[model samples]
Target: MALRLEIFDLQLFIHIVEVSSLTQGASRSAISPAAASTRIKNMESTVGARLLNRTPQGVTLTSAGRSLLSHARQVIQQMDHLAFDMCDFRGGLRGQVKVLAHTTSLTEFLPQALSGFLAAHQDVEIELQEALSDDVIRAVSSNEVDIGVVSTPVTTGALWARPFGRNRLVVVLPSQSEFVQLPSITFADTLTAPYVGLSAESALNRFMARVATQLGGEYRPRVQVSTFEAMCRMVEANVGIGIAPISSVERYVKSMNIRYIGLADSWAIREHILVTQHLEALPVLVRNLAQHLADYAQTHLPGPVELSYGNP
Candidate 1:
């Protein structure tokens, strides 16, 4: 007998394996326990293998089940992407690309880059979200977003990453502050003074918090503000020294009475990268948007002059 499978069955199997309880999985799939059990039995019979090991505790995937789960996820992802593409034919929109990035890219870089891309591709739309670097990587790995822009080095296990831009952290302080005269300063030294901080939830603030913890200290901000510009203004009033990206710092330094100094820590200098599951496997429109972002970064962003970036 030839093996045959249904998409609904595959999706049901995924749901069941994820939760480890057939009843709960059936509830999630909107099918009754009895019907779900029958479907699973049918699937097992067709595949000629036992898929699950069930007990009163719950269920665990057998070796055959693990194999099916992997293929099922891939199939689901492909179907989702296919549906997204087919929608363009039914609707007026040509395509939509989902992108995730950190705060610096969202605020300082992507606004201008996306504006140009949007202007050129009038029929295409982009959905953008701000997240921390780890969250960005997870989203890209799970196929939750079409692309991700992240700072810091990433563990390239299964995902593809290409250098997107170069940026670094800088200390923004009042021009007359005594610390401004120093040639260079570590991140720990900046924490000695009361500092203006970005919103507690922002990616940069969280990153700084982690760095502080690593150095056996704490990040205690004098007052928390929302934007880099706002933080700069707070620094101008001598509220406290603030840390921000060089791109944003340069934009405000001439007008504000604040000066920025580069952080001495090696981690302060970041190589932002574009992340995806598979570059060549992306849809034509998504691949184009990714290329446009890389090209825009090369021309408009600053990076190490000696090294080349982006995919070869």
Candidate 2:
């Protein structure tokens, strides 16, 4: 009888090769190192050839192993895609969509969009995780998540990305503060004021830093918070002013005693983006969700927001 090679065995072998260590590969696959080694040994026996050579530095793929790596990866990717397609058939739009979003999108924009999506497609489910913009991209690129919504431009590489919408970065101040009367504020106006800064690693923070640099002054934020909500809380308590996406402020407008002011001469716009792995064939459900988001943005999001950013 011909030897039957299991998908699990091929996946284990490929993980071992890519990680260059049975231990690391096992960790990634959530299996014990011994179990991973046994799987590889079984695979070699089935194939009638030694697949890897273990050395002091680490494991190196043998000629046969090197030859099989590409085919193994292709098989694994196809299997995953197949699973997604099968789920789509069974659940329709109700299947799970694992999304990684930035703080602003999670707190401000996605709630309404998700509500509308779920109302229309009662079967679709969404799982959300919040992270910095850069990490959101990484999650989607590695296929750890299905989609990412972030407030930064997506660059070319291993993922396909498009602009989902545009938001402005507005300055938030105490509603009763003396600065409330100003028609517009400049970066220089914020220099001497005690300000709350968003996390330095966030996309919004980088934009604020650039604005300060352009004004030939330093941004001396008295407090730094990780989320837009926290920044608003601080500003409400009279800790300091803050800058965040306008959408975030709108969500908290009624409850929070804060006012949002647009900055004059500041071209700081937050571009919400959707990112996914570059695939020759995308699952029907995933493609449908992407188009839904694009259509929603066109009707709801204000202004002439470009589709892919470059198309602008």
Candidate 3:
């Protein structure tokens, strides 16, 4: 008959090798030291070899024990992987997904994708919030949100992140504006121009304001509207020009008499990232949604991205 192995025995042995103390390993395994000794003895008897030498200070592994230590570690590691890997095969889906996204992602891409996700996942509830990039990252890091969509990729310690999409900033102008005649307009040149802005509470508005101030200019909005479409409307009315992501204003480009000018600024280019804690830790429904979002990004956007930040 083949000797049956107990996982706890292997774990106890590995921990003993790690700490050099049978008592400490037994404590970690939640077994009494006497019971641990019996288990080790039984394990040794089954293997037909003495495994360790008990000492006054601590325990030292015998040559046989040293030989088996590497195998024990491999077995424990594989068991841990198995516990997590079995979850991958389960097809269970149901949970709430609290999502926080920055302004560009909230306004441009996530709506359609989220709608599709909602349609597919009837049992899953989604609570979405609009926040700035930094705030979204913080929320995910702090476990306040299940997922975050950010316009710019940043260091997310202990979090898994993937590229979601792009949000290239563009200038919305009336057809007759002289600046619109140019292929692209500089931020400094547009700072002096009449601007239709979003609410002051909006991150994009704050970003533009900060940029203008940094360039030794002020953002004087002719009118402040809540939505990108409203900003485009105000621009179409020749009230003021607006700065928005091309994705946000694409629908209005053909129907509305407006010009989409690229912003000649490095910051104009923005990459969107989906960030969250470990995907395996999330509920089945949430994990599925995350995978769908990643898949969508791969197919629709540039490509798939998997970032495993090794350090916390």
Candidate 4:
């Protein structure tokens, strides 16, 4: 007779791989190290293979462990949804939606849209995090996040994606700056000048850094700040010119002494998209959040793009 895999074992495996330490993972899962070791051994026995390679430093996933991680995560997510649904049947709509988004979407688009969704679904919670467009897509594909918003073009291989909105990257300069006379400028041209930049960890900064590298240049800022608003303020003080999404620049141009121009690069026009693994397969709470994002885009986005929820 074949032995069966258990949910507890799968969860423990995930915790262990994530922390790279069996002891720490067991502590997080509220189990003793001895019991955790027993469960792991049982799991290996059931599969007829070793999952982890333990060392003096920490544990590393074997090839089988790497393959199992994706499946384990999907199973765990489904089980969690099942538990949440049972609670919902006993009371009201209750569950959390995990979301990953690029910096522009998080800064300009999601706040109002998410606020509206949360207001309507009082019991639903959201866990939002900032990631680059590529990272956002990876998280959605891996089931690490329920929803993802990105500005890059996505191929429909294993994930479903729909356009939600559009934003343009613009160059902001001090009013007295020499470059202010140009109608539009390439992003690479700005790389040669002193720059006011967002923090190094920001998704936008990372994206720009990659672009600069492709153009055989570096994006070293004269000074770095936390927010787009602060970057514009630095430009206003003639600290340095900056580049940011038009949605963010529009809010500050009226009050700040900064001039913004379109970026000549075709990549400057960003088409925002929402990505998910399978809309129909996801929990109702997750589907509702996707619908709310679509509705928000239809109503608020500037362009004449018509988007419907059924595409998901």
Best prediction by TM-score:
4
lDDT of each: 0.83, 0.73, 0.79, 0.85
Superposed model 3: Cα runs more than 4 Å off: 1-92, 302-312
For residues 1-312, what per-residue lDDT tens digits would candidate 1 score against the true structure? 657899999999999998999999999999999999999999999899999998999999999999888888878777767765676577643577889999888887788888988987688888998888999998787676788999886674688777778887778878878777775689988778998998988888888888899999999798999999899999999999998888788789888888777688898778888878776787666777788888888888767623111111
Whole-structure CA lDDT of model 2: 0.73
lDDT (Cα, 0-100) at 255 in candidate 2: 88
On lDDT, the leading prediction is: 4
Specify the poorest-scoring 10-residue window by lDDT in model 4: 303-312
Q: Between the candidate structures 1 and 4, which one is better when assessed by TM-score?
A: 4
TM-scores of the candidates in the order shown: 0.74, 0.66, 0.65, 0.93
Candidate 2, run of 10 with poorest lDDT = 303-312
For 1-312, candidate 3 gives per-residue lDDT tens digits of 786668889989988877889899999899899999999999999988999988998989899998777667656644544543455466434456778987887877788778888886565678888887888888777555678988754667788888888767888888888876577778898877888999988878887887788898898687999999999999989998999887767778778988877788877888889988788776555567888888888787643222121111
On the 0 to 100 scale, the lDDT of residue 166 in model 2 is 75
* TM-score of decoy 2: 0.66
Tell me which residue pairs clash in candidate 1. Answer: none
Cα lDDT for residue 90, candidate 1: 75
* Candidate 4 lDDT tens digits, 203-304: 988888999999999998989999999999999999999989888887898888888887888888889998887778877778778878888888887673
* Per-residue error (Å), model 1, residue 310: 32
